[model samples]
Target chain A: MTPIVKPLIKTEALTKTYGSIIAVDNLDLEITEGEIFGFLGPNGAGKTTTCRILTTLTKPSSGHAFVSGFNVVEEPVKAKSGIGVVPQYLNVDGELSAYENLKLHGMLHGMEWGKMKMHIEKMLEFVQLSDRASSLVKTFSEGMKKRLMVARALLHEPKVLFLDEPTVGLDPQTRRNIWGIIRRINQERATIFLTTHYIEEAEVLCHRVGIIDYGRLIALDIPEQLLKRTGRFVVEMLDDDRSKARFFKNREDAGRFVASLDRDAIIRKSNLEDVFIKLTGRKVID
Target chain B: MVGTYAIFWREMVILRRRLIRVMASYAISPLLFLIAFGWGMGRSLQVEGMDYLTFMIPGLIALSSMSQTFSIAMDINISRFYWMTFEEFQTAPISSSSIVLGEVLSGMVRGMLASFIIFILAAAFGIRLNVNWALLLSVIFNTFMFASAAVITSMIVKSHADQASFNGFFIVPMSFLCGTFFPLSRFPEWAYLIAQVFPLTHASSCIRAAALGMDIPLISFLVMIIYSILFFLGAITCVKKASL
Candidate 1:
């Protein structure tokens, strides 16, 4: 019999509050090893707050959180050593070169010079920034800076990586490049916890997706299962400046729904975004 | 320890890149003050037994060190707001204590460098005074006090404008009223009592006395040390609060 493996990351009744407002309501989560878990939330939905708690940057107000078997509040240093965080914003040093930035990160992790040198070179190559390693980060394009942030986060060979909106502002081509990099990194069996508002990114990359709204998890499942739970097809009706989606069990049913509408309507396969809209009565990005 | 060095190293690298700008900013104002006040108005005036330039040298050192130490808060604010580099340390394995220690040490180093620059400018104007261990100790304590104060202020302020306003309200007044320009003996009794409340007042008095080959007052050194400890504690508390 195959043994049941424990999750690499777990949270039980975890909550964070600011004065009178709750930023993250009682959240319970379990992310297994080597799984890419996507956290989908709109702006002000507390995804970043959850990441911060798990990464040990902020403490949870109640309950418990564990990263790589170490409690975040009780054993923060141990948990931090096992996890790498790529924040939503660009946090790399603008005055320092990419190489120097990564070096500082490595040093903070207590890596020796000899190992850090080789690791930095390998990471720069992995991110395809080998040639621009010596350039100041302020001079790099947005894409290059994002790639460099990835390199710095991966420098210490962390077992778990938390990427918060890693490709929030990038051209389509650059976004695809980052997607490829993320895929390659996930292939090495690292547990990835990613938060993004981009529907396509969640559908394409996550093995499992969690939909959060108003500081609560609304849905959790594999992308295909989530879409299937809503329906197999979607019928979208376009009005003057508004759109509405209706899910059907099959293509014929969707076509029938479209035919019944006296306005412009498009029938297509249901996606993760459709499931999110069906659950929340609002667009994920909006 | 490794984490502290990492933070310090980053500051040193940035300082190296902007070395010229830093030196100019530290040197220009003090040079102007020395020329206008020391060379112009006090060329013939004697304070105690020495020329005005000689008396002003130690005061200038104390003032420059205080200003330079406080300037570290601007750098901290820039990193916290614009660069977001402080978040890097926040998510790392470093402790909050390490972060405070690293920043305070870097500020002290910058403050000492500014004092050296002022010393060089003094020499350029052909003003020399006695330099000894007492003067060095006094400057170190002064830098520690202000650097720690800067850290506390940086964590409390919200924006760059807030930081600038803090300097405008607190640092500028301390620079002028802390016996850096004129003797505290010239002030009325109430004003003298107010001046004595500032850490810089003791720092300037201790440094000036040592530079003139007089015995350093035990009270001034003791008060500066107490202020350093208080500010250091305040800085650590604020840093931990900000991390949350």
Candidate 2:
């Protein structure tokens, strides 16, 4: 018999309410070590709220959360020590250089001076900001600022990292660069919990994606399996300003479906966005 | 403690980078006040036993410390709204107490720097008085009181304009009427009662007494201490509340 490994991050019936509105409702989740879990949701879908609760930035209205086996609410300092958070907005210290920003984060985590110096160098190199280490953050491009934020979050080598919309508003090349960094970090066996509304981002980077809607977890599975829930292939018919889609069990069926349509239609593999639309009756970016 | 120092260290780095700007800010107003009030008006008039410049030096120190400490509110607002750096501290393992302490200490440092600028300006005007430990302690207390107040106001105000309005409504009036320009005895009886309510009044009284080589009144020291404690508590409460 094999023993079951406990999850590195777990939440039991976690909920948060702002007066009459429930931001997160009866949420239950478990993410094991080394797993890259992506939280997919639309605007106001409580993705950031869950991250806030798990990261110990805000208290849950009820229930509990644990990060690296430490209860977030009860042992917030310890939980915070184990988890690193990169918020959605660019929160870098603009007055300080890239190296100084990372160094400040390390010092806040109580890293020894010798270790901090080495870690700052390593992080600057990891994010490809080594050349800009001495430059103030205000002078950096938006992409560079995002990379610096990632470096700051990872400076302490945390066991779990929470990235909230890490690559939002970046150019395509920069977004892909950030994706490569996230994949490289996950390859080192650090659990990553990311929340993003970018459907392609979740499809390409996340091992398992959780779809949330109206403050509820609507679906949870691997991207392939979730896509399978809708169908194996998609037939999209483009109109003047709108598009309609149909799902089928196989490529042949999808091709037939496209042929039967009078308008121009295209057949392709189903993706996480299809799953999200099927589950929530709305587009991910709507 | 490491976290607290980290916060303070970041402030120091920025201060170092903007050293010229900070020095100018500290020096310009006090220079103007000395020129207009002490050099221009005080050369002819005598209110107390000493020259007007001597009497106004302590008041200027108290007023400068108050304004410098209250300027922390603008820094906090900028960090919270524009840069969002306060969220970095919020998500770290640092305690609320450490954040408050670090910010208040930075405010105190600025307050003392502004006082020292005024001191140099006073000397340039040929007005020198006996600066003692009591005078230093009074300035420290005054700074702590206003710094804590700044933190509270920063948390409560929704916008930078709101913070400016707070200065316009509260700090501006206090600067002029808190015995910073003249003695409270010059005010009418009802006005004197109101002036006594401002913490800067006690600070000005204690600083002037100490600078003149006179005995510092125990009650003024006690009042300043009590106000510092209350404002410090209020600041901590606001920090915790804002984090939520």
Candidate 3:
């Protein structure tokens, strides 16, 4: 038998409770190295809470998690060093310039002059904000701020990057630009763990995704596998009365066509949004 | 230690930018109080057989430094919680103890500067220092105790309203009852006992005694030292347990 490679990040029955409510409940996950793992959930669904636990910002109520094999609670400094987190809120120091933000981030990780300067420049360029590096963060657009945050996270070149809604509010172009940066980072062989409600983003960028609702992981698999798992064929039309009637009348015909078509053609039409609503009875925010 | 120094440096740089405003508000507040009390009411009443200015000046300096220290701490905490700029530092590798240490150290520095400024103004008013280096150290010790006590109060505060109301609950009470604005002998005997429960009274007694070149009680000195240590520990503990 071929040897198995250990996962870079793992959690065993990880749990966190706030007062009477459980923010994260018995979450067990194993993320292999060098893959973009999307944690899909609606707001208040424990995505940020789980990320906070993994980042060592808050301790779990019970159970344990590890980053790069270092326990989050026992070796928080090592775990923090191994993982980079970009929070959903813009936690950038608005008074500081873009370059100064990265410089401060490097200093926080104990990086000094020679290496700090090189890493700051490289990370800024990687985010395509090198030209605006000297401007104060308060002056930057929302897109620019998000990009700078990514650069700040990459300053120490963490082994695992955790981004919570990295593209919450931005133009389509800026969002695509961010996706490109994420892809480039994955190409460099870094493990990426990001939480997002954007189904298309997860479908396009993630090698694997975990759908969470009510603080529980309802589904976890590759996109294609998840699509195959949910009934192979879905003949959907507009929600108008005429479209609904047409869809119902042609359902049998569509099924026969799918059956007669290439055996490899699973003809699955369920988008991630549809799968999420079916699982949670809540709409995934566009 | 290096992380502590870095935090200190960052605070100093920020204060440097706002030096003029901080100076005018904190250091100058006590000077204006001294001028108003000394010249305004110097002839109105006899204060314990000594010049009223002599007794009131040390207390004002201590009060000013204490209030300034607490306000600075409260502002920092409020910003850390509400504005969330403190997340940057909290997420850093620096320990929680270092964060409180940096804040306490900076508060002490500011308190010392306020004391020194008041001392100069007193000199200009012909309130001779009696040239005792030991007395000077005692004044600084008392001032630091006052500042540390305020810092402790600020650290325990949970909300912006708590920060604002600290003056009503603590600062005003300390000022009026602990001989900052007047001698406690003027109050009823029961009131005097109530004032003694607060560490500020012992601190004011120590600094006031030393400033007039009078011998301070050994018990008062020890009590002030104890207050400083206790409040320092309390402040550090509060800060360490706080979440950013």
Each prediction's TM-score versus the true structure:
0.96, 0.96, 0.85
Q: What is the Å distance of residue B232 in model 2 from its true position?
A: 1.8
Instruction: Write model 3 residue lDDT over A174-193, tens digit each, in one string.
Output: 99999999998889888999
**Residue A182 accuracy (lDDT) in model 1:** 89
What does candidate 2's lDDT look like per residue over B97-154, in tens digits? Answer: 7888889999999999999888888888888878789989999999999999999999
TM-score of chain A, every prediction, order shown: 0.96, 0.95, 0.88
The C-alpha stretches of model 2 lying farther than 4 A from their native spots are: A238-242, A259-264
Fraction of native contacts under 8 Å reproduced by each candidate: 0.81, 0.75, 0.19
Query: For model 3, what is the C-alpha lDDT against the true structure?
Result: 0.76
Q: For candidate 3, give the docking quality class from DockQ.
A: acceptable
Q: Rate the local accuracy (lDDT) of all candidates.
A: 0.90, 0.90, 0.76
Looking at model 2 chain B, report the run of 10 residues with the lowest lDDT sum.
B42-51
Q: Considering DockQ, where higher is better, how would the candidates rank from best to worst?
A: 2, 1, 3
lDDT of 1 by residue, A191-240 (tens): 89999999999989999999998889989999988988999898888777
Window of ten residues with lowest summed lDDT in model 3 chain B:
B235-244
